[model samples]
Target: MPGPVSLAEQVKEVWTSDEGSMAKDTASNRWPKIVQGMVDDVAETAATAVDRPQQEEALSIQAALKEIKDDMLQNRVLRPLPSDGRDDIDGYNERLEQLGGKCTWLACPWLFGECYLYRRVQTIFALTHHWRDYDIFKRQKDSTFAKSCKAVEELSARYMQVIANSTLPGDATNEEARKLLFVEMTEVALWGNATDLSLLSNLSLDQIQSLQGREAIAKSQRNIVDNDTDAVWQYLSSPLRFNRRIDIVLDNAGFEFFTDVIYAAYLLESGLASVIVFHVKDFPWFVSDVIAADVESLFQHLESASIFPNRSFIDQVVPRLRAHFDSGAMSIKQHSFWTTAYSFHQMKALAPGLFKSLQVSSMVIFKGDLNYRKLTKDGLWPHTTPFKDAIGSMGAESGIKVLALRTNKSDTCVGVESQERVDALNEEAPHGVWIRNGKYAVVSFSDGEKTDGK
Candidate 1:
């Protein structure tokens, strides 16, 4: 059998080749537009600067953005991140140098280059005065959330119904029922990834709604190709369940984030976890990855009568979320490692503090495709490779339980039961198209208990 194909090798396949996959679209279309949008935003914000120095800084930032866009279009070699006094910049530059000192936008590793693109964009704002804390993607994230009102209402109503009927801690009568609810909530969180902005850049409100709600989930259950939710439930319900803290490495901002919060709320309310810590990126990332401000934005939007039309549902749900924050049952945390290009396999070495923090959690749930890719080192491993093996150092014996709830949207996947299953999928869809469509998913878990090196 052939050894696993690295992401760089997979880039030569039609799915990742310059033909039509996300790599092509991202480098050729999405990034240039994103940079142009940032340029426009800087111009608009600069007009409102309070003083001359701030205005001058904004203009300089705008010029820097334009130059970055040009370099991307010209396929120039990737450059080192300017010294921003942030600890991670050195790590990023070192990685770039390791990859090859002359890697270009299109020619470089897809995962690393994509990460580098965002980090380079951050340098422009980091060096600026008034815009240092601004999020270039905030407007897009907010607008996407605004447009997802229908889906939001449906999920809020459904989540509330589940909560109303759920059995609390120590309620043994409906243990089976509670288990079913856990599956449903996990599925809800899994499918919510359909709305990620990186892949569905032109997604419409109707398109988003079609992918959400109870009906959508019911119809899509069969599409979950590799399900370990039962194992996850067992892990959570066993002796290891008590006084548990669950860490969520979050994904996109809009509807997906809403569902993720609902899942966290369910875990807390069911006493499956004592605390839920949400890990968000420190800056704008992959277009819509959640950051600290998004949490605030979500609550503020829920509070505003003008934004979301479902006032009754908001009234019921928003307070529960706010109470989680108020009573310290929930928390939002950020780490520079999340935004860095280093894969989760490198977590122990690259970010030991974050690694140690996750070790204390009952299970750390990594959400969405990018997180999945990072977990597996974005390698084209045989589809039947065990989930634990794919995750490397973060797998068994690492003392950090992990559950990856992801809709397959990239070329890399593992943990399926057999190569025959993967062959059947390829036969059905041809050319690995089934993996990138976002119609299928994987609910994979690692128990973190094995001590053997094998």
Candidate 2:
């Protein structure tokens, strides 16, 4: 007989019936809509196919995607992934097998269920000959990026000023200036995640603009109940941080990615880091998660004459980005571990190499809600739990300097001061709104200390 579920396993389970739960809403409402949209995108591809073979493959993929949506709606048992030559397939299937008969879309852990849906969607395209490399989420990603041009232009002007003025290789002369710039750029990057495509799907151009810009950013400062601005800045700006290498496990593409790039540029320019390594998803993921192609595509958009009217800003910024790539100051890395269903706490055992590589970095910045969820294990941690304690192995014991920047959009939250503040916020809003509204944020940081649990 299967062993009784451990306390750890019990916390991992995020059932769809939990009242006022994002997991429940996602499994029931959000997922079907997402999968059906993929079916529509695939149908469009099928109709536009140049040949019969391509059309046939597209139709098959569409059917498979539709089936996924139906399964979610029907709450069918979660199945092991079909063998697809991918290295991570076994790990996913094994996870399902371990669950025995209790696994289903609305009944399994929220984190695993969400990952399975995306991977299953990717599998449909993987099995096809003609559409194997096709990105079903490409249209939506590009469209959203295009829609965020105003914010893009606004940020461009702000970022270019810093790039044009700052010194590189050494900038210790103006300590206060560097510190202020770091705070501004980092905050810009933190809140950029408010527009994650997986949540807030129906945001208009005006709403997008409202979430960005200097005025909007300044206004959102009060919403950051848990602040680590000083802690992160003090560490990054410290004289001890020579030869710094910053790794940003990225979130959304387009506008958010642009903000991240700007933040990276500030680090490189102010001599904060010698190099920046961006971590991207190996496959298309979570609607807008950074894939390899999106990075290049963003630069193309940056250089576009019609999309952005500020040629002077574009001329200054675009080539600088290219230079970073050319000079090896900035690079992109992709590992399949990022797209897996497992929490980052399991990284030590599951993806030892990736975990080891990250240990050498100055700091690893996890952007957006999903990465934050993975870091914190997406569990029912009390709102008052310390951020360091919430991340388990990814915390102080692992000796990884970790910074998680996310606008809240789910149930798992920690690192706030007290239960009183949480109670006050809840009283002012609808139930569960304070935690998942995407209006509030947390900038939590931890050091690489094993001795005292820094």
Candidate 3:
């Protein structure tokens, strides 16, 4: 018989009912066919896998999903306090935080998207089941990292010129060169959003051809936050020039962490920055940030066959990715920068050493949606507040050049300073949902020295 379900498993058992149906609705609306196909593929993969604890669990999950799909098809009504009620909302978020504490390994990327948590939760509220919010955090922790492709290699080449020009030459003390380096570092920070494969499929991440055309660039721009796109682009190619080290407030793990390491390696390889600091969570974080196991997994991704199935693509990328780590062009320093909860206001309090260390880097790039959320206090501001003030004394206290390239996921959004900008967004996208969607983004730049309230 199957062992009794653990708390984590119990939380994830939502797919057994209709109460946990939010994921089903969202999946149907945004990516019905894609979700269905992925589920079907998982079922096929499960049937072929050798027996193991994880594989068995995967099979069980596959079985559970069929019921969830049937619930969706039948238009089952769940009891979970009506999906829109505050009780359901609070219950869902509370469960996420609870599950958030259980797994610190950063393995739960699929909670909000893939994995079975959301789907299960939707089923949990079936009229036959008591109305209760299903736990959505379980699958979130499971689908955190997966395979990669040639996107890393293509990205390495795409930014090569930018990287080379952004660094300083030996014995070249020209002020212009320093300024240019600063600009370059700043822009490097901006382009951080150019490609993120965490949520994409293994095939998508692996295909080199996927990086072609203006689609990647367009995707990055659409993910801009606060509507300060020019500023974001300018920051991308801009140099920090300040006499300081570089700090990357990191997010995700597995391939995403590997990509971040690659970016750090590029900074050092190009001579753009002296020392690089990586700030990671002290505990399990918003899923897929970084954990002890992540370092090993990351190296495997770097060394393993890349996202491309072709051996030639792998041959070309292996050396470059290896060279970055082998040459000591990058070093990672893990710190508890993410535990400050929703506000980076406590950033100074949590890691004063990091604040002091930023003095050495020309710039600091806080990567991903969670860090951005903390920076802007989850977009709960008055909406007219300046980005600088939103960040407040956090950056000002240390005189670090703060550049964040983040898609709008959580609430805290800034840098859109004009009604015209808002109007433009409405014209481009009539839906007010643009603010919350990750499709539109902002590249917010704030100089610690400038009091102009960015």
Candidate number achieving the greatest lDDT relative to the actual structure: 2
User: What TM-score does each of the candidates earn?
Assistant: 0.88, 0.90, 0.56
Lowest summed lDDT over 10 consecutive residues: which window, candidate 3? 199-208
**Candidate 3 regions off by >4 Å?**
1-147, 157-243, 306-329, 340-342, 359-361
TM-score of 3: 0.56
C-alpha displacement of 120 in model 1, angstroms?
0.9
Q: Pick the candidate with the highest TM-score.
A: 2
lDDT of 2 by residue, 346-410 (tens): 99999999999999998999999999999888888777777887787888778799999998898
Q: What is the TM-score of candidate 2?
A: 0.90
Candidate order (lDDT): 2, 1, 3
Worst 10 residues of 1 by lDDT: 197-206
Worst 10 contiguous positions by lDDT, candidate 2 = 197-206
Using lDDT as the yardstick, the better of models 2 and 3 is 2
Query: Comparing candidate 2 with candidate 3, which one achieves the higher TM-score?
Result: 2
Can you rank all candidates by TM-score, best first?
2, 1, 3
Candidate 1 vs candidate 2: which has greater TM-score? 2
Which stretches of candidate 2 lie above 4 Å from their native place? 1-13, 164-174, 194-219, 451-454
